[model samples]
Target: MDIRQYLDSTYLKTAQQAGLSDAENVEVVKAAVAEAIEENFKLIMIRPDMVAIAKQMINDAKSHVLVGTVIDFPEGKSPLEEKLAEAEKAIAEGADDLDFVIDYTAFKAGNIAEVKQQVVACTRLGRKHGKIVKWIIETAALDDHEIVQLSALIKNCVITHLCEDDYNHVFVKSSTGFYKTENGKPNGATVAAIKLMLENSFPLPVKASGGVRSYEEAVEMIQLGVKRIGTSSAKAIAAGEAASGGY
Candidate 1:
């Protein structure tokens, strides 16, 4: 497949977490988004704290950029109502899209009903507000069966809601930067989950995140059928930096 064409359709996220709060972190993120947008990127995702600043940047830019933010972010341990409220607030604040993490604990504990309920609640709010929702499955922590089961549930939800199959409504994503393997290599299980979603006909996109810090890795994921690439190192990779280098 043509990589550039796929890149044109993919959403690139400039993620900021509790770390990287240095004086230059925000500036770097802004510059990355600006550069990515200039390079023809269609979507940019930022943290809730940086949403206002990101909004200002997007407003001042000459190009059109879709802004997104994470709700209940890297962890989905937050209460269901709280997550929904956060999604509502993000949409109200000019966030065109919202990416929410699935409750890993709930899923691991076999509380599949609760996990599905949370995803449904958040997606419902997103739809009501005319905003797009990307359900982050956090694939790093799930086994093959769990991944398949969640994919099926998401597909069922999308069909029940009558949403488009390519609606960007739900995404199976990798790690949240918390866990890693013994060798420190970023796990690629999420890629497998994404393939599962595609094979199962889930009505959503797939986003690969966590240790994706290079253009080659980004392209690899894209070649594997991911439609979105989430990273804080977009600028570095676009500039041809190696994945091992700091963002």
Candidate 2:
């Protein structure tokens, strides 16, 4: 299979997170953008701050790789206005996809209204601008039931409040690949979580992120109905080799 097209080649680390200087981190992001262009991956997922850089690089290269950026990132605790503001800036910076980290912690805290409000607002904001929107639930932090509930929640929010055309534009994504779980458990996408998402978020599509580090794993996620696979190891996975990376 042409696995590269299904991959969202990703690099979301900050300077401090990667233990590098700001300039050095930008260099790393530049390298990743170049690699995605060379490999012809579907998109390059990055932090919002790097959206302009990635967009400029891809445009200069005349490559078709789309630029995606995170909104609210690993922590989705930001207020709805803050999330929308970040997304607006990313869109202005030429981001093609806006992956917003859903307020999963709020959802877990029985703040369903907060979660639902942001989901609808963010999804509409991205879709209104013709940008793809993916809601990352940080699945590793939740139980199986929460995964299913949250997936259904997103699906319902789109279908109930948005137009039918928006359904295909919005996605229920699996993880951020940055969540730290107890006892070193897998902090990214798992078969169980993906299955729950797929089962609950049908017609809206699902993107499996995190913990998928090999070509086999990518293919497996596709086989299970994921429309996209986000990973830092997209290059190695495309080569059919096992990749070594935290994501």
Top candidate, metric lDDT: 2
| TM-score top scorer | 2
Query: Against the unseen true structure, what C-alpha lDDT does each candidate score?
Result: 0.66, 0.94
Candidate 2 residue pairs that clash: none
lDDT (Cα, tens digit) per residue for candidate 2, span 1-247: 7899999999999999999999999999999999999999999999999999999999999999999999998889999999999999999999999999998999999999989999999988998899999999999889999998999999999999999888888999999998988988999999989999999998899999999999999999999999999999999999999998768
Q: Against the true structure, what is each candidate's TM-score?
A: 0.81, 0.99
In Å, residue 240's CA in model 2 sits off its true spot by: 0.8
Model 1 C-alpha lDDT per residue in residues 58-80, reported as the tens digit of each score: 78876576777878866689989
Candidate 2 — which residues are off by over 4 angstroms?
Answer: none
Model 1 worst lDDT run, 10 consecutive residues: 4-13
